[model samples]
Target: MKPIEVKNLKKQFKTTEAVKGINFSINQSETLALLGPNGCGKTTTIGMLLGLITPTSGNIFINEEELNYKDHQFLNIMNFASPYVELPKKLTVLENLKVYGRMYLIKNFKEKIDQLIEDLNLKPFLNKRTGELSSGQKNRVSLAKSLINDPKILLLDEPTASLDPDTGDYVRSYLEKYKKENDISILLASHNMDEVTRLSDYVLMMKEGQIIDHGKAKDLIDKHGRENLEQVFLKLVRQKNEH
Candidate 1:
């Protein structure tokens, strides 16, 4: 089953068009990477998906049901994680998780929180203020909060951005396991080409607010005569600008 379907998605800000009729679908249990340079509308597209921003024009369906910004029923089934977007600075990690769990009306909230704490190895910092934690610690907490409700669709932005290599790999492995166990779908926006290649089943390459190229990561790499995804991305972006 397709977990997400976006058709002719468009978002505009004054004279600038940030997302220009992009279309994509993510199947259940699939991981998709959205790759683009800064100002390429990746974030804008994500905002529309999360109902944080209204699209200028488009259709978005989640699990075959059309999304209504005001009706949060479907929103409960989705969650997003990003180090760039911080939780309340004053809230302790446990408190923050409690708040998010309450928002989702999760049954047995404490049990769920405990499970996440253990699963994410979040025991030591549970009482620490969100603002007091290091960047890598905060990223882990953010991820824990995102999964507090056991969402079916996960949206992540640079999820492993600041972590050391070991921690980053650990987190990636956890995501792979979580998806397989729960049949979760993920849409990741990241510049970490290595992470993308490791986690994503497919990749969409965007430039100046439109999808310029897309394919399976391995296929794209080979098709473009590149040794890696980073090379393929650079080649495509540079080629787009030259034309």
Candidate 2:
């Protein structure tokens, strides 16, 4: 079974249709990029998958089992990372990881925490309060927490946003290595064209709450007669708006 499968997924808020019957899946160890401008319902779609918002209609399955939103046990195997979500400011980096580890009921907490710190190069700031760290550091900590459960499916929302090139590249590289070492599925939502091109096996271009185009990054760029994914993205989004 695929790591994730969303069938005819949809969500509506009052009179507004936030998601217009989107359907997709993430295969084992594959990365699928979700690309679109603001208010295109990318966040809403991810929210639905995370069970933060109940869908008006659809099904989400993991490991071929339908997901029940009330079943936290099912969600234990899934995790998410977003730049906008913050951990507790008062807690130290180690403290935060330890806290999440307990929540995930991770056995051998020391070993798991140590492995994450080594893998993420988070040793230096392990003792610092979360609020004292820079954006890059906080991003790393958030990632470590996400991995506490050793999730099989990861949902990333603009993970590398707001970072300098070096830090962003570092995170990207680390994620690449991690994906290789573990057969994990990733669903990424991002505006960073370079990030998508480097990481995505397939790209879904969404507009007006629906996927207007989808293809491998190179194919989409070539088909749109653009030099790169960013140009193709602009072309499609702007063309839709002009209609």
Candidate 3:
């Protein structure tokens, strides 16, 4: 069983049809990139996987077990990180990590928190309120919270957005090393083509609530006769619009 799998997933918000029967899976120790334009159902799909939204139809499997919304034990093995998702503004960085660690029922929580603080360089502002941190600092804290559980599966949405290039690169490099050493699976959604190409072993391109194209980033670039992912993305989005 794959670490993450979606079988014929669909979501309908009244008549909007936010997701249209998509299927995909993430293997152990691999990263899959979900790429699409704004409102192309990327967020909706992630919402379903995270159990934040009920799917109108279809199923989700994590660690080979079917995920039921009411039974969230499966979620202990999964975690998500997003720069756009806010942590408690009033809580200090250490306080926020404690909250998430407790939520996951992590044993040896202090050890885990300590390791993450050092790994992500969060020690300097560990006692500062989350809202007071710069964008780069906040991003690191979000990442540390997500890893508190030492999850088997991770979902990241624009994990590096709004950071200076140096900070962004640091985060990307950290994720690469962490994934390899921990053998975790990742499902990443980002507009950063370079990030996607570096992190993803497979790619799923969505359009209008459906997967319009998918393959290795290199394969897609070569198939589309483009030099890189950004160009390929432009071609796909514009081609659909013209039709």
Question: Which number leads on lDDT?
Answer: 3
TM-score of every candidate: 0.97, 0.98, 0.98
1 versus 2: better TM-score goes to: 2
Candidate 3 on 1-243: residue-level lDDT in tens?
A: 699989999999997988999999998899999999999999999999998999999999888788899987878888999998979999999999999989899999999999999999998999999999999999999999999999999999999999999999999999999998999999999999999999999999999999999999999999999999999999999998998
- Model 1 C-alpha lDDT per residue in residues 1-243, reported as the tens digit of each score: 689999999998999999999999998889999999999999998999999999899899999888798987888889999988999999999999999989889999999999999988999999999999988789889999899989999999999998999889989999998998888999999999999999999999999999999999999999999999999999999996887
Global fold similarity of model 3 (TM-score): 0.98
Shift of residue 210 alpha carbon in model 3, Å: 0.5
Which segments of candidate 3 are over 4 A away from where they belong?
A: none
Candidate 2 residue-wise lDDT at 36:
97
lDDT of 2 by residue, 40-124 (tens): 9999999988888899998988888988888867788899999999999999999999999998999998899999999999999
Q: Is candidate 1 or candidate 3 better by lDDT?
A: 3
